[model samples]
Each structure stands twice: as structure tokens, then as C-alpha cells.
Target: MPATLPRLSVGETVRVAVGVLAPMLAQGVIIRRPGVVSLADSLDTNRHACRILGDLRERYGAGPVLLRLPVRELAVVLDPDDVATLLDGSPRPFTPANREKVTALRHFEPMGVLISGEERRALRRPWNEDVLDHRESLHRLHDHIVAVVAEELEGLLPSDAPVLTWDRFTPVFWRIVRRVVLGDAARDDEAITDLMVALRAQANWAFLRPRSTRRLRELGRRLRTYVADADPQSIAGVVARTPGVPGTAELGQIPQWLFAFDAAGIATYRALALLTGHPAAMAEVRQEDLPTHRGLRPLARATVLESLRLWPTTLTILRDGVEETHWSGGTAAPGTGFAIISTFFHRDRSRLPWADEFEPAIWDDGRAEISRALVPFSAGPAQCPGRTLVLDVTSELLAGIVSQFDVAAAPPVRIRSERAMPRTLAHNRLRFHLARRAAG
Candidate 1:
């Protein structure tokens, strides 16, 4: 056990947080002692670990939680200020070295820029920079996504049947991304969808090297073949044409684009649900004739940003301290690793007065500082470059949905929030019912 700290009020929160993390304890094993627990069992996955960290933040203020495994030590930090410090000093003092990317994804994307150091980050720049430049072109795919969502809402789910939000949105969302990035042909490609489905499943136990590796390898092969001569404007084209740094695999950066589909869908669905929960907000969104969402019309943007605040796609981000770092009046030793649960700070009343409330007004006027702190895309050099495009696509798709029909929880939806992390473990399943508008 680690040395106990003086009984601060945060102690209770730490206890609760640890209790919450119990279910995820995988059956760890030791080589000498038959059934001894290992650090492998300490974290079910990075996402699961972050959920626990979020709990720590809620239970304790923005501080560190010390966990002393048999031979190793771990610290989970929940402070946003620390997060800024950690991420701002990326690739050196703070680095992304997780079980999933370093282990399972190695075979497929050995040089994956997603969790790479500064060099790989720069090598992968073209793909992301291209997306940033051509976001408008990608935004044009909003109509197709709306059509896809509309069809799901109108044709699939009705008074008689309802679909789980996770089940419903993931395929549609990924499909939209495929259509926009790959090409219009990908919109209806079953092969691509099947591959994506397998990969999505792989995302959970990827560190364990599940059956999904076959699929991931298959995806890498497909990208290598199909993307070789892709249109320069298409996402696949940019990825294919991107010059790989020395000693990196050809298709290294594809996973970064592919994984984003999952996060984007989660945030967008929550935004829709928030809109449904607040009819006035939905109405305001519908009335706005916003062309592009560079900075979305306040109400629509707020709904999205507010939803992100409530349910950030990334539950926690892990960074290893390579050098002694100082932040929020403390020093973390070099080699100490920390996971920041930004959701905790986003919801902390001490930081934002209306932390528990969904208020778009906070994002308005001159409060970009508060909005700046709400980092669902994360912070610093590795922050998601594709955020603006995702938001634009979300705003337009929501507008299209409202234009077609009035959507709501059919028998009244209920959202539960007792989890370590938010968003991904969405509480509402039988989601959004639609009634065809009485002719606008």
C-alpha cells in the first residue's frame, strides 16, 4: 500500500473512486504466486482507467491519487491546470504510451502518429493539415449524413421499435466519415462497413490482441491498395500521398482518422439528446440559417459545446512525465505518469458556477476563456485538428434532422450518470423518436 496522506476531505472521494474502479479489475496473475494480482489488471483499458480518474476528480479536487501496486506506482491527476501543463509540453515531458497503441496497433500501424513522439507527430502533419484546409469540402457531406440519420429516424425507429443510441449512431456516424473522407463510393460499401465494425469491436480489447487484428491488418492492406491512386482531394488521397518519415510504415496515420469516427458520433448524439431535452434550444437551432459553422451560430454551437462539456468524448488522457514538471503549485517527479480527467473539471462547480447545468450563454459574450477550458478534443500540440470539421458536420446534420421531423424521447428518455467517465458509456439507449413535421 502507498503511504497514506493526512485525512483530507479528498480522502473520501478517493475511496469512492477506488470502489468505482473495482469492477474493472481483470484477473491479474503473477509468475511465482499463482493468483497474485498484476498491474495489468489495474486498468481494464485506458478509457476504463480514465473513468476511474474522473471519479477521483469528482470525489477529490484537482489533485493526485496515488496507487501503489506490488512493485510499481501510479498517479492519476484530475486537475485541468495540470492537464494544460502536461499537454502543452508534449512529446518530451509528456508522452502518449498506452497499451492499445504501443502493443496491439503495432502490427498494423507501427508508426502510428496517434500516440507517437514529436517526430511522428510532425510526419503525420500532412494528413491532419489537409483536413483542416479542406474541411469545407468535407462539410458538404452533411446532406448525406442527414439523409442517413433521417432514414434511420424515419424508416428504422418509430413508435413500434427503438434502437440503442450506441448501436444506432456508431455505424451511421462511421459511414458518414467514410463517405466524406474516402469517397461517395464508401457510403454504401458493405466491405468497408464490415471492416469498420470489426475494428470498432477491436477498439475495446485491442491491447489483448483480439480477433480484430485480422481486420485491422486487412484495413491496412486495403488502404495500401485502394488509396494508392486516390483523388488528391479525398481523405484517403491525402493519407496515401503523405510522405512517410524514415522507418515508418506506409499506412501509419490511418488509424488516427478512423478512430475519430467513434468520438465524433458520441458527442453528436449527446448534442442531439440535449437538444431534445431542451426544446427551446432545438427550436433555436432549427431557426438559424447558418451556412458554415466556423464559429457556429451561438445557440447551435453552445448546444454542441455544452454537450461536450457534459460528456467529453475523451474520458481521460494519459501522459508520462519525462522531466520534472511543475503546475498548480506542485512538482511531479520525472518518470511519474498522470491521467487527466478533464470532465471532472468541466463539471466542477468550484471552477464554473453552472458546471452542472447546460447553459449556452456561458459560451457567449467575452467568455472564450471558459469555453477554452472545455477541451473535449484535448489540449496542446496533439489536440484534435479535425474538431472544426466534426462540429460543422454535427451542426448541419442536426439542422437537417430538425428540418425533417420533430425528434424526442418517445416514452420519455432517462439519462443516468453514476459512471467514472461520461459520453462513451451513454446511459440512454432507446433513443430519439421522430414524428414527421406537419409540413413546414
Candidate 2:
């Protein structure tokens, strides 16, 4: 058994020191380098970095083990069993509020039911009700998007063979997502565009400097200013008041969560584009699964799970120890920051067994049990409240596209590069050939 690791504070320098020591203790593992797990201070190389680790997990058991990432941070994981304990345990021992370093603040205000926990529960049912609870609604929305995709592809594709890439694919899909979320009326509004642009810019900055809490805070303030200036109202607000939305005391937090909402719209969806279009995965779906949009939800969920496993957008899950803790025979003082890379945890293909194949079939049966390692949308009480809604949206959209059009790989998607972090593609481009599908 290894000795107890030292207790460290939450500051930057201390975090770096942890990075240095982690490698020695973790041995020649991939998690040793912070770059392997961090989305900051590198050339957005974490994707490629995880690919390297993917090579390792392909060899090693994807069980509780140490790894080295490109950035400089220490990681400790207790395999899938331990992960379940962390995620599904009572009181969830490790709460999001405990670790400001890792909690995503850009989606919805941390106020109201989200922060209170009660509001989170209340909002969860309704949001899913409006989105997922109504299966017919999801199908109708999916069919609409699929039809639009066929039309868009017709406009974009020449009457010749073309390669579809992220640049062409993502924008068309983004529009589809917007229509689903806000309805067609809100799709082309400049206000939405400006809001998304600002949110993306802030995420780009966060990716470049994960430890710059102050910078993120400033970005939050700027976002608040944007909202204040725009005086935006929620589309849901049109449907119902955000009863559990943040209170006046928590009004300051609205922009941060709002930013997260916008960020997920693109970041997660872009990942969807990349995964679905990967040559191997694309061929199967286009040829085989395209006929039946039946598995769209399961397939899309599997896709996001795989992508999150490989290129975790949040990168790491941060936890503050409730007490002197023991993990994998090592201990940390209470309050010490404990981070586990979802990138490593998710890619441990052994967990998914069929991970390398990209066959969405593995997730088709709702009854098929999966290892607890998959947490793209996160887990426990603080788990993404909108998980069902997002999954429904992405799955239906992908299914709709594949069922309607013969999407071909185009040029590599173009993105706006952040200096150290990976660039956000200028667009998710793809060339398209219309598919001849029987009426649904």
C-alpha cells in the first residue's frame, strides 16, 4: 500500500507541486502529466494526448490506475466501483460547491433549485417532461430537423462526390439544435448569436487557463454585463417562469450558468459531429443504422459517452475530501483537492468493451448495464439536470441527419484556435448527399 499523499491547498502553485509529485507516485503512467487531463496551458492537445493514453488503456486494464496528462496535475481514481461510490453515495460526500476549481459555472445560475438541490429536483422532471417526457414531440422535432438537413445538404453539395467535415456539418446541425431548443422563431435572432459568441469566447479563455479562476470570474462579469445589456428572457420563460431559477441574491450567478447552457450547445454537439463523422463510425451509421432512426437516442447517448470518455470537455471531476480519506490504499487530508480525469476514466475501453468500435449497438438496450465510469454529463446530485433533454436532442438530430442525407466527410473543420488550448472550429463542416429514405 502506498503512503498517504500530502494535503494540499487549492491555490495554483500548490497544484503544480502536486503535478510534479504525481508522476513519481503514479510511476510511468499517463496520468502523471497534467497535460493528459487538463484543457489548459497546452495547444488544446488534450484530444491527441488522450489518444496516446487511449493506446495505453487499450493495453492496460481501464481500472483504478494512475495516468499522466499533458498539463501538470495529479490524478487519483479508484476504478469503477469506487467511482460509483463517489457518484452515487449518500450525501454524495464530494459536493460540487466543495470544489470551485471544477464545477462548471456557465450553464445555468448556481442559484435557485440548482444550488439549493431542491430546485434541481423540481426543475428536472418538468424540463425532461417538455423535452424527453413527450416522445412524440422528440420524434416530430427529429423529423423536422432531418428534413431540414436534407434541404441544407442539397444546397451545399454539388451533384458530385464530396467529403463532409466538421466545418460544414456542425453549423447545419447547430441550426437544428437551436430550432429544437428555442423553436424556429428564435433560431436566427442576433441576440442569440451574440450571446453564444460571448459564451464561446469565455470558454476558449477557460480552456487556455483552467487555473485562472480570476480570469473566469472576470469572464463571468462580462457575461453578466451582456445579459444585463440584452435583457434577455428565457424561451422557457415564455412557457413557464424559471420558478426555481436563481433568486435576486443569486442573480450575480445567472450569467455563469447561462454561459454553460450556451457552451454545451456547441461544445458537446461539436464532439457529436467529430465522433459521428469519424470514418469508421460514419460508414456504419450511414449504411446500416440510417434506415432505422429507432436507435437515435441510444446511439447518440453512446456517442457522447464515448467522446466524453475520450475527450472530456470538463476534463476532470474535482472533489474536496470530507475527511481524511483512503483511496486505492492512499490517503489525503480533508479539504485536499481530488481530481479524476473523465478522459482517462471514459476511455478505459475495457469499461465499455466495444468502445474502439463506435458501434452504437452496445447502448441500444436500455437494460444493458455499463460500468459507472461514464459520466460525460457528470453524476450524483450535481449531475447535469438536463441530461435527458440534451441526450434526446443530440440523438434525434444525428439520427435525423443520417436517415435523411448521405453525409460525406469534407475538409477538416475550421476553428478559432486558442494559444495553448485546442481551437474551437470556425465551423463544423460536412458535404452532403441526400439519402432516399422511405417516409417515416
Candidate 3:
């Protein structure tokens, strides 16, 4: 018979909640709250979480350590193989549409593929993949996206202001997002993004707070209008073209794309931070002929991947077991929720020699591919469908930025390459100094 899974003591559970779970909530699981983010950064929340989870792993010995939460069976996965199992058996033995996720995402994307039932997921997933060009690194709308990046990023380095703060860069980033996802017509549609922000803020509360029906409806109506226009160059246009049954939630999926782009924006900024610190990596980025390179630039893509590895935007990857499952430690009953704290694996020093360093070569080399734990976009069947498209857009944006200006992190946000990278990078507080390159 298989051994029973170890259960965390009540006190241990509370510590896990405070040390690991609470930080994720505080950091804003849905839309990041600025004040809380500043606090979290000062506190270095992720590092605390790593220590808490690491101690638990040492005690439990590669746990799916059961937490003592009321009215729910939950476990925190520690082993890399189990992480693989949980992700690989997605929407089956383990479903991505777990309770907390459903409760949260319902606020912004009620019918998104992430929280959909099998039938609806089957339809929506393929539609998302097709539209996003899931299999290809360079999206079908690659040229348009590159053009959007080039245009929006043009004035970022003005002669009067060489400083690039988050405030300075955010609007430019959003304009690119709007144009890519909703077309050039919606480039200035701050109203739609505002609606999304409001709803996602509600989502951060999950089931504790009441749903903002009025805001959600308004967001839906606005998204539908964009879909109706179906500008051929945008993802919304692809959604409009894709045929679906009544409940496919065609418009529903679009919100997630927009939402995911918000995290992508954070990652993009963090990538700039990483490049700012590591002159060697930035030098490699500068070497690439970005203007003529049509496909994803290898160095630029790897740098973005490294940024994600160092500080993953998605705090936790949660899944629920749909049926009874046996693990090396023991068996988990059906409906058992599993939490994968990605930072633990990504920065686990024992397994990864370069865990805490700014290393992009791991991605290009065979190292990152061998590890199941380095899931920047997740793995297996339930992995993000838009991974390729996101990488394409972000890498292009990074390449575009570096091609024009020399970047260095501004005061109060220091990234020293000689030292180990910080566990949590506060993208909001991040600022850069950009100087225009002399014409050759």
C-alpha cells in the first residue's frame, strides 16, 4: 500500500498561509495593487515564501504537503516530478479550472478557457491556439506587431527627458497592447483598459467580495464592440472570424488575452531591468540586426525568458485533482487542490547552479529544457496557448528598445550583475535611463 501524505500542523499551515499564500494575495493575484506592490517589494515577499516552502520541503521530504484549511483539502507540491504530473495531467486528473481560480477569473473572464469545463474548453482552446498561432514562434500578425512596437516606442527617449519611469513607459506599452489585441483604432482606448483594471481588482478578492456586475457587463459590451469592428490586423478580428456555438465564449477569451498582456508588460519592463544590469546580455542584444530580423531574435527572446525565470509574473500555478491520484508519498483524494509555488523551483539553489544569477544562456543551452520546474509559461496540456505570441511581442519590443537607446536602471532601483539577482523585482517602481544612439 502507498504511504499516506504528510499533513502540515495547524501552526505550520498558518505559517504557510502567511509566508507563502498571503504574499501572493498582497502582490495582487489578479491586478497588482500599487501601494501593496511597493510594500511587498520593500519586504521581499518572494524570498520569504521561498524560505517558508523550503523548510517545509526539508521536513516533509518532497511533499504534496496537505494543508489544514477549513472545508477544503489542499496540498503544496514540492517535488519537480509532481509538478510535471500536475501540469501534464491537466483538465483531467488535474484540472486548471480549480475553485479559487474559477472564483477569481469569473470576475473578468467568466468563460475563459482557463476556468471552462471540458466541452467548452475543447472549443475555446483550439480557437485561441489558431488565432494566436500557438505552434509558431513568429505570429501571423508579426509584421503588424513589430510596426506597432516601433511606432509606440518612438518617443520614449526624448531629448528633454532621458529618464524612463514606469509612469512614462506604461501608456506607451498599453497603446501597443491595444493596437495589437484590438487594432490601431483602439490605440488610445484607455477606457477599455480601465474597465479591465477595475474588474480584475475585484477578482483579486475572489469570493470574499461581491461581483461588480455593472463593471463586468460594461467591459463585455466594450469588448464586443471591438469584435464587431473586426479590424483584420488584430486578435479581436480573428475572434470575430472564428465560428463558434452559442456558449463558446468567443468574446470571453479576448479579455484573458488583454489581461495576460498586462503581465507581459510587467515582464517586458523587468527584462529591461535585467538588460540594464547585465551589460554582457545587453551587448548580445545590440549585436542582433533587429531591424532586418523577421523572426524572434534568439538573444532577445532568451533575455525575456531569463527575466521570467528570475521573477515570474504569475505568482502561483494552481490546479485541482479531479479524481483520486497516487504520488510517491501517498494518494490524494478527489477535489484536492494543488499549489505550485513556481519561485521555489525556479530559484532552488540545490538543483540549479545558476538559480539566483542572471543567466540567459540556460535557455539557449539544453539546461532549461531538461528541467520541468522552469515553467515561465507553464507546461503540458493546460500551458498558456498564447506563449509564442507573447514571446514574439515582448522580444520584439526588447529588441526595438535596445536598438535605439542605451538603457540603465535609474536611482533607487539598482541591479548589480556581480551580485545575485533579487527575488522580487518591483516593476512599478522600476525606472530606466535611456540615451539615443548616435547615427552611424
Top-TM-score structure, candidate number: 3
What is the Å distance of residue 266 in model 1 from its true position?
1.8
Write the residue-wise lDDT of candidate 3 on 153-191 in tens digits.
Answer: 886976788999888888888999999999888999999
Q: Predictions ranked by lDDT, top down?
A: 3, 1, 2
Over 4 Å off, model 1 = 1-17, 20-63, 98-101, 104-109, 134-169, 210-213, 229-233, 240-250, 291-298, 327-330, 366-368, 371-373, 415-428
Stretches > 4 Å off in candidate 3: 1-3, 290-294
Which runs in model 2 stand beyond 4 Å of their true positions? 1-3, 6-75, 101-165, 203-242, 245-301, 322-324, 349-355, 365-368, 411-440
C-alpha lDDT values of all predictions: 0.57, 0.44, 0.88
lDDT of 1: 0.57
Which ten residues in a row are the worst by lDDT in model 3?
287-296
* Residues 258-323 of candidate 1: C-alpha lDDT, one tens digit per residue: 656556665677777777767777888878754664335557666777777776556556677767
Better of 1 and 2 by lDDT: 1
Candidate 3 lDDT for residue 31 = 92
- lDDT string for model 2 (1-440, tens) is 55664322344224433443232222212111223322232333334434444543344333333323334323455366666656664234554443343233332233423333333435443443342333342433444544544445443334463454434444555564444444455445445545544444443333342434454456446444443433123222222333334333323333333333443544444544554456555545445454465635455556555444444555566555555556654555555445555655554555555443334444555412465667776676556545544555555555445655554433443211222213212222323334445565
**Using alpha carbons, what is the TM-score of model 1?**
0.75
Q: State TM-scores per candidate.
A: 0.75, 0.59, 0.97
